[model samples]
Target: MRIALFVTCLNDALFPQAGIATVTVLERLGHTVAFPAAQSCCGQMHANTGYAAPARQLERLTEDAFAGQDAIVSPSGSCVAHLRAHTALPVYELSELLVDVLGVTDVGATFPHRVTYHPTCHGLRMLRLGDRPTALLRAVRGLDLVDLPEPEQCCGFGGTFALKNAAVSGAMLADKCASAASTGAEYLAAADNSCLAHIGGGLARHPGAPKPIHYAEILAATGGIRE
Candidate 1:
């Protein structure tokens, strides 16, 4: 399969590892992963904040960036949700592509740490991808999937939410991080960097947080060990 990765701005800047892990896992699975140079933001921030005109302009640009591909895959479910709903192109969440579309599971990887998943607002409310990521995680060789206390809750980073409503966002993140910590999980992973970073900041503020991981990092565990 020829797959194109839409590395959103957040992943490119703050969480490049998720982008790397995404490429690593896809190539390891025998698919050609192309990082489109033209790809950029899907205008989610603008749309979420009620800035219609710029959001639509940016969305059109995003469509042009991902114009042709067997399938466009994104590590962030929020972005993928945008493509899935607002754009005409076929889009897939990384986990949904691996577990549902491609029919490839058990990624031949091992992650021996207990981990919980944080479903971001866009992924859960926008995409409604229930149990799909969890199912894929469970199929990994040595993964121990734990039930997040409130798996469906948002971590409160709605793109600009953390910056705009720091106090409210921080409080919500505290609750999410506390839930992840209570699970005794080594990692609190999610598909969205915006949320993961918000939760991670809360962890950094607190004494001992499990620290959030991008789901792709766990999926790409073996170093691709390189060919």
Candidate 2:
């Protein structure tokens, strides 16, 4: 199966490893991955900030980016959710495509560390990816997946929400960081790096805090090495 990766703007700019890992994992599963370079922001930031016209324009541009792909997959559930509501094209989050479309969860990965998953607001509520990430993590050889104390809680990274409401966002992130720390997990994992960036920022302030890693990086791991 050939899959086109809708590498979102943020991933392209800051989290390219996630996109690379998505391609690696898909190739490991015997699927070809294509990068649609024409893709840009899905207008999520513009739409969320009340710029309707620009958002619509980006929607059209995004549609044109992967016009002919049979399958569109993104590592970001947030971006996928935003597009899924507007596009007629099929868009699947990494876990959704891997589990639902491909009918496989284990991507031949192994990470021997205790880890907890933070289900971002978009992935949790918008995409309703309940247990899909967890299920995939469970299938990873030698991985010990721990339950997040409050898995449903947001990491407070609602795009510009962190910038607009810094204090509130920081407080919420504090709570999330504490929860992840209590799990005794060495790694804090999530589907969205936007959330991980927020949570990981808080974790960075303290000594010996768990590092935040995207789920794709974990799934793309070969043996005990993380991408």
Candidate 3:
């Protein structure tokens, strides 16, 4: 499959490894991954923050970016959910593409670490990803997948919500961090780095917190080495 990777702005700027790991997993599966340089932010932030006009414009530009691809795949569920709602083009989150469209579970990965997954709101509520991510994790060669307490709880990183509702966001993040830490996992994985960034920022303040990681990075691992 010739897949166009929609590297979301957050991953492109701060979490490039997630994007790279996504491509790594796809190519390792014997599929061609294309990067459309014209792709930019899918305008999710703008739309969520009530700037509908600019959001619409950016959505159009994003649509044009991957105009003629077999499918558009993104590492971030938040952006994929936004684009899927706005555009007519086919957009799939990494897990969706791997499990539903491609009909493959084990991507020949090996990561020997205890890990827990936190389902982001967009992926859980909007995309309804369900167990696709966990199914893939379970297939990893040596990974120990632990159950996150309250796995469906939001991390309170609803884009601009973190900035606008600082106190509430912090309180929610503290609860999430506590839950993740309780699992005794070495890493906390999720599909959306936006939520990871928020949770990671909170986890970083404390010593001995589970390191935040994207699931793609785990899937891209070979011989127990993370990307």
Candidate 4:
């Protein structure tokens, strides 16, 4: 498959590892992947913030990135979900495709510590990704997939909404972190880096709660870090 990597703006700046890990996972699976230079933000931030006009630019950029590709995949569920909500094609969530389409039960990554999943709003609600990530995590040899206290709650990092409403976002992060902490998981994993960044920023300010990690990192661990 000729796959294009959508290294989302947040992940490109804050968590390059997640994007790198995503490419690593896809390439390790014997698929061809491309990083289109024209790719930029998927415009979820603009769309969510009543700036749908600029989002069309994103659609243009993504359409360019997806040109002639067999499938388009990304580590960020929010972006993928946003596009899926708008268009129709073989675009897939990394976990959804990894488990359902790719048939990769074992990538050889080792995450011995227990971890809980925090599904982002657009990904969970819009994308409708249920427990497929957990199912794949449970299949890992030494992974301990702990139950998240509230599996369906938002991480309060609604892209630019977090900055637009920090107080409410903080409260939502507090609730999310408290629940994740209650699970005693070493990692708080999710599909979207944008929410993870907000949750992680909140956790950094809070007294407890582990920092958030991307599900792609776990999948990359199966093959271990490339660099």
Give lDDT tens digits, candidate 3, residues 1-227. Answer: 66999989989999999999999999998998999999999998899888999999999999899898889999999899999998887999999999999999999999999999999999999999999999999999989999999988899888888999999998999999999999999999999998998999999988888999999999999987777
C-alpha lDDT of residue 77 in model 1: 92
Residue 123, candidate 1: C-alpha displacement in angstroms: 1.4
Clashes of each: 0, 0, 0, 3
Question: Residue 218 CA error for candidate 1 (Å)?
Answer: 0.2
Pairs with backbone N, CA or C atoms under 3 Å apart (clashes), candidate 2: none
In candidate 4, which residue pairs clash? 108-222, 109-221, 109-222
lDDT of each: 0.81, 0.90, 0.93, 0.78
Q: Candidate 1 regions off by >4 Å?
A: 223-227
Better candidate by lDDT, 2 or 4 = 2
**Candidate 4, residue 3: how far the Cα is off, in Å:** 1.5
Model 2 ranges off by over 4 Å: none
lDDT tens per residue, model 1, 1-227: 66898888889988888888888888888888888798778887788889989989888988888777878888999888876777897788888888777888767677877788887777788777787888878876777888889878778777776788989987888788789888888788888887887788888776666867888888888532211
Candidate 4 residues 115-215, lDDT tens each? Answer: 88887886678777787777767766677888888778777777676788989887888899888888888788888877787788777766656768898
How accurate locally is residue 141 in candidate 2, as Cα lDDT from 0 to 100? 89
Model 2 lDDT per residue over 1-227, tens place: 66799989989999999999999999999988888878899988898889999999999999999898888999999899999998887899999999999999889999988888899999999999999999999999889999989878777778888899999988888999999988889898999988898898899987777899998999999877767
lDDT of 4 at 48: 81
Error of 1 at 77 (Å): 0.9
Top candidate (lDDT): 3
